[model samples]
Target: MAEDSSWMTAGAGECAPSAELHPEIAHPARIYNALIGGKDNFAADRLVAEQLSAAVPETVAGAKANRAFLGRAVRAAAALGVRQFLDIGTGIPTAGNTHEVAQAVDPSARVAYVDNDPIVLAHARALMSGSGHGATSVTRADLRDPEALLAAPGVRDLLDFTEPVALMLVAILHFISDDEDPYGIVKQLVGALPVGSLLVLSHGSGDLVTPEQAERAERSYDPAAAGIHLRTRDDVARFFDGLTLLDPGLVIAPHWRPDTPPDAAADRLGIYTGLARL
Candidate 1:
């Protein structure tokens, strides 16, 4: 790994939003942290998480399943000899981070994590200290801005554009509404990479959740947090367009190459996940 310590010097001013942290508002990352039983979230995040859990009892389980699917996807990519990873929308650093899983499989693996949340970067910096010095770096960039995210110093420093990279979009695409041209966003990011690159994605689905449950969940994030837009399985499958989907294409989170026997309860999580290669 080459030394590009410039990414270290670039502070939040360079890539992060200038707005102050609003503890009163429920952020998607913090709420996800709370749902995963992490202690990094605040009162507002916990409140919204709890409300969603009450409305959709499987919501918590769905979050956990999504994380597990991410780990499995990363490991599978590593097995395929893909060493570089660009994980956009990486929530609060939890147990199996992208760099952790990829590096475990191959020590030389490099990961660039992109998130818009300042708190996530704060925790990530602390977690990365004294570890993964050259192999891992975090950047503040929104998925909506593919050019800025692709050009971010951290991403440019850690990942080689010429090489095969695994682009992980786990549980993050839902925040991007149709108006944002989520499909075009995916294509733009994928287009920058060379052939043989992989796209690993897990998205929230409305196919399983009842209309009432979906309405309640959307209401929870209406004012304070980023709005939720759960798509159908067919809609999510469109994300892998023109790519080769691996076995068990576009299934629920836990069903995509699970290490354990598929749990019947996982089907209720309302998340569609898949791994595809260009």
Candidate 2:
């Protein structure tokens, strides 16, 4: 992708909040970007990725697997006739973005990409500006505040609460610590959706790693803006409470209706994913 010098500027007549590029601090999204072989991150982010990868050699593969799960889940939702998407904690723009995949299935599909990271907002805006799909918006919001996130102008404008929507929380809920009430946050978001809406989520886990590896991975993310809180499979399942999980419920990322056959060790890769209906 070519660098867009105007990415920092909101399009004519648009008023989106701007964020500072704090390159010195490690951000979870940027760290994820680096892990996925993206170029939109900084040295601090790369350091976290390097340290985490060193501790758990499968870190990169796990990240890629999580991303793949997002694509498959989105495609499945689109194919199911859900036309609106509310993708929270959207990381930096990359291949097979929510809108790209959904719109490919149905050009009329609409997506609202929400994230607190300024870099992600900038890139999303740039992506939206050039999008021929026409029904996309980027909102700067934090998942910790579900009410505010649900009411953000971009989200409310692009998505209809009365209609079925696919709420995507892929590879992001792990960043929310228990103190932040991650479950409550998800509940609020889901409750706001209609009965037919779907929740697509993926979370990191420590279940497959030894205590030492988990500790080392935690230490690597100590300086990040949000610390990684790998949850048990049961803990992750709590996020789907009051909702019915779709086919292939709560499996490892690669095993969640995989497009291709998964390797034997795919279950040990540490990311649990599921798609559910309200």
Candidate 3:
């Protein structure tokens, strides 16, 4: 590999998808991007985001809190000498991306971002194309198919399976319904990685929201869009089963080892997050 900016497109082949982008429908990636104040989303995504926000006034703040949690977690992993990252369900790239946080710790860090949406793949390619540092790549792959994702060239190219890797599943697992066997999916991905590897994840929670608010929020994600399935703390904790959970296990997103003292509003984020070692 020539490295340098050349490595920016090192895994371009992995992100190409046969499915076309459906701009008319609301997509999870675009909605999240819009919540984070990114310009990559369409009006459909904005509608869904606004609907959710109206139902749960705290949603926009919650989404930003989730992003902050991601940054803190990635930086913590990087601090622990994790130079490689496999970030699945990586939505539209915004401020504090995984590679940005990891590379801040070590310039040579490598990251492979995976997402199923074609629009996300396109925006990811554009946002990341010329980073000119670290081995960063984007791939279009479904999180449900861990086998295919693990076999993707983008992952195999940018990350060495033999070493300790940080697998990030931030705010994405909720898209998977119970019938999808989400736990099994996590197990398959974690089992493939070497010993001492880490699993870092954040998921949506309905513990704080009223039933009416949760139902209204759910309606925003129509059948055409990726459906949301919020779980409770106990349900979210199951994903970290069989792995050693780090301190402050499975708390609301902003409360997880915050760089600054967490405020009372941090509890209203309506998300749970944790880091675990295999």
Candidate 4:
């Protein structure tokens, strides 16, 4: 993979917001980190996270489950011979990262991790040190503009559009409301890839949660801020309309090719995940 300045030098003058100062008051990324019991979050993040957790303990389980699904989906696609991966909305890096999963399956695998959160970028870059020197990189970009994320030098420098690639949209599309055209955004990304490319995704769904529970979770976030727009299973499945789903089609997080079913299948955790090939 070729080195690019988009992450270090080029992004300095670019228009993008970061989580450097830790806007704990209403920071979703930090709150999510707190829910996962990570130390990188602030007091405000913890407060919101605790409240949200009290509203739904299944959230914590679902977060970890979604991450596990990401690893499983990545490894599965790698087994299919896809070497390059473009991970969009990669939240604050947890234990198993994109490059780690892909590279574990194949040493030469190249991955580009993109996210708008400054904290995610900071931690992800630090984690990549000494390991994926050239194979893995972190860039600042929003999911709303898949084109910008795809065009980011860190992405283009390593990934070749002519080859099959995996477009990872794990646990982030729920933040994007219907008005933002989340479906259109995904379609644009898939349209850019080659024939054998894959679309890896996980979305928040009201399918598993009761009406009151789903409403409570949605209201937990500040309406002005990014809200979790929980969709029905059918609506969630529509995001992958043109593509062919992998073995476990649009199932709940744990149901989609789980290593071991965690004995909590009936209690829906408001998340649905699936992988599809183009």
Task: Give per-model TM-scores.
Answer: 0.92, 0.93, 0.93, 0.90
* Residues 73-161 of candidate 2: C-alpha lDDT, one tens digit per residue: 99999988999999988899999999899989998888888888878877777667653845777777788888777777677767789
State residue 137's C-alpha deviation in candidate 4, in Å: 1.6
For 56-119, candidate 4 gives per-residue lDDT tens digits of 7688888778878899999999999999899988878887888888888898887877877777
Q: How many residue pairs clash in each candidate?
A: 0, 0, 0, 1
Which ten-residue region of model 1 has the weakest summed lDDT? 1-10
**49-87: candidate 1 lDDT, tens digit per residue:** 999998799999999999999999999999988999999
What lDDT tens digits, residue by residue, belong to model 3 across residues 31-118? 9988878888889999999999999998998999899999999988887788999999898888888988998899888898888877
Better of 3 and 4 by lDDT: 3
Cα shift from native, residue 264, model 1 (Å): 2.0
lDDT of the candidates, in the order given: 0.84, 0.85, 0.84, 0.79
Error of 4 at 156 (Å): 1.3
lDDT for model 2, on a 0 to 1 scale? 0.85
In candidate 2, how many Å is residue 274 off? 0.1
